[model samples]
Target: MELISSDKRNQLFERFAHDAFHLELRDDYSVPNEVGPFEDWLNGRESDDSFMAPWLQLMKRVTESGKTVRRVRVVTEPHSPYIQWEHATTNVNEEAGELIRWLPRHKLPAGLHFPVDGNDWWLFDDKLLAVGHFDDGGRVLGSEIIDAPEIVAECIRVRDLLWSIATPTNEYQL
Candidate 1:
């Protein structure tokens, strides 16, 4: 397996933010120290509309493309307020209900998957894989933490199984 650098991983996320599909596994999305990059991306839209406009357009396109974007978050303790704010402010929860769906630990989508290990998050596209590890400070201790091919394959498999058992959030509400 190829080892991707932290800078490269950021670029990958930016790429994903633009066009590629994304999958994230975390305890919650709102850790201020942990979500710095994502927060930067979100805040950029407010300051430099031009910078995030294209990505926003791409997000709309992806949502309309009928391609499934999956995120599996292992909820533990109190949920992240930042994540809640993000979901609420961007209306990602409603939009995600419509476009993205949750996968249970026992099942997963056809081509995507990941385990719910604490702080171990993986982002997958057709060929590339990005992994990140955060310390208690919410600072990224390292993103190039996992490089073993077998580990990647295993994570993908685990994600698939979970997706199969997962339920869409909207379905449970009503």
Candidate 2:
């Protein structure tokens, strides 16, 4: 698998034609840029989300261009601290034009299987997938693209199903 730059992975958002969808399965993400923000949250500080400005800007630009951006996060009922922080800060994403939803693990239909390598991913335009790789400590290790029709199709199916069942951000509190 080839490791692609995070910038390139994010660049797909600008180039996609119809819709962009992301599936988040992890309980934690120890991204370097987020470390400080997470720490602030843990210390009872409000999330400024300044670090997310660039991506938020892109989301606004793309959505304003008539494209769609959505994400579904499958989280445990008693979410991890990271997820709590993410949930607390999700308004920023929504305000910037990304629609996010959450699904509790227990609410997921039994026997459901995720597509591809079973990691978190972004499926763009129903043609390409960018899957994230992580270490045991939850730090990101970049991502790679998959364009095979069978794999992409399965991912699309999984995405649609999860999105259908996820609770919209506004409908959820916590």
Candidate 3:
């Protein structure tokens, strides 16, 4: 698996031709950069949007270009503190124009098929995938790029299925 760096991921985003869809399966993420802000949030601090500004700017630029940015997160209900933190901060992304939805884990159909790898990923233009890699502690390592049509197709099918049933952020609450 070839790992792509964060800078390269930005390049992929800039170069994607159409929509970008993300599937987030993890309930918790131990992102080093988010430690301080996450702690602040836990202590009842709110973003003046500074911590999330770069990503908000990126999402704004993408959507203003007439492209779509969407995400479907499969969350475990009675949410993890990390997920609660994410949910609270999601408004930044929404304000920047990314569409997000949530699917409670138990709501998914039993015996449903999943991509063989079953890793969280960003599917760009329904073609290329930036498959995520994480350490045991849930810190991101990086992403591996995959452009296989068969795999991308599976991801798209999963995305379509989840999007159809997932609750829009406004209606979802822990």
Candidate 4:
């Protein structure tokens, strides 16, 4: 297994955002301040009322431009109303809800996909495969970057299966 440093993983994401399909799955959408930089970025904005404005704007542009940005949230402990509130305040929940409403969950066929247990993220771009590991502090430790076809195929399969079972943001009747 080849190991990739954190910096490399960030670069990969930067490039992947522009070049490849992206999917992210998290155990819970909400995280503590010390766990990720997203909350800090949101709180550090110049205006309190416009918190998450930039994120919302970007999401709007992405959706308007006709691109797919799929995300899955696995319900677990430590659920935070703050996170949901933020999404609602920014209109992100509404936007995501609308997008999901158009897509029938039953149309998603069974297949393999990646599994996100919170600390690791597996990515597949064509024939390349990367498995990133993070420290308890939420810093990427290293990644096993491989070009093996079998490994990439397996990761793809895992990703598909997970996607199939994920609850659609809009179609979630419960």
Top of the candidates by TM-score: 2
User: Stretches of candidate 3 above 4 Å error?
Assistant: none
- Ranked by TM-score, the better of candidates 2 and 4 is 2
- In order, candidate lDDTs are 0.47, 0.89, 0.87, 0.46
Give per-model TM-scores: 0.52, 0.96, 0.95, 0.49
Candidate 4: lDDT of 76? 28
Candidate 2 lDDT over residue span 42-93, tens digit each:
9998667899999989999999999999999999878889999999888889
Q: Rank the candidate models, highest lDDT first.
A: 2, 3, 1, 4
- Cα deviation of 131 in candidate 2 (Å)? 1.1
Show where candidate 1 strays beyond 4 Å. 1-7, 13-25, 31-58, 61-68, 77-90, 93-99, 102-118, 145-147, 172-174
Model 2 alpha-carbon drift over 4 Å, by segment: none
Query: How many clashing residue pairs, candidate 1?
Result: 16
Question: Which of the two, 1 or 3, has more lDDT?
Answer: 3
Could you give candidate 4's per-residue lDDT for residues 42-153 as a string of tens digits? 5663324344454455555655555444444433234344433333343353463223221223334455233433333445355565565655555545776766777666
How does residue 67 of candidate 3 score in lDDT? 90
lDDT of 3 by residue, 15-115 (tens): 98889999999999757678888888788886454767788888899899989999999999899988998998888899899999999999998977768
Residue 79 in candidate 2 has what lDDT? 83
Residue-by-residue lDDT tens digits, candidate 1, 55-86: 45544555565544455443323445554433
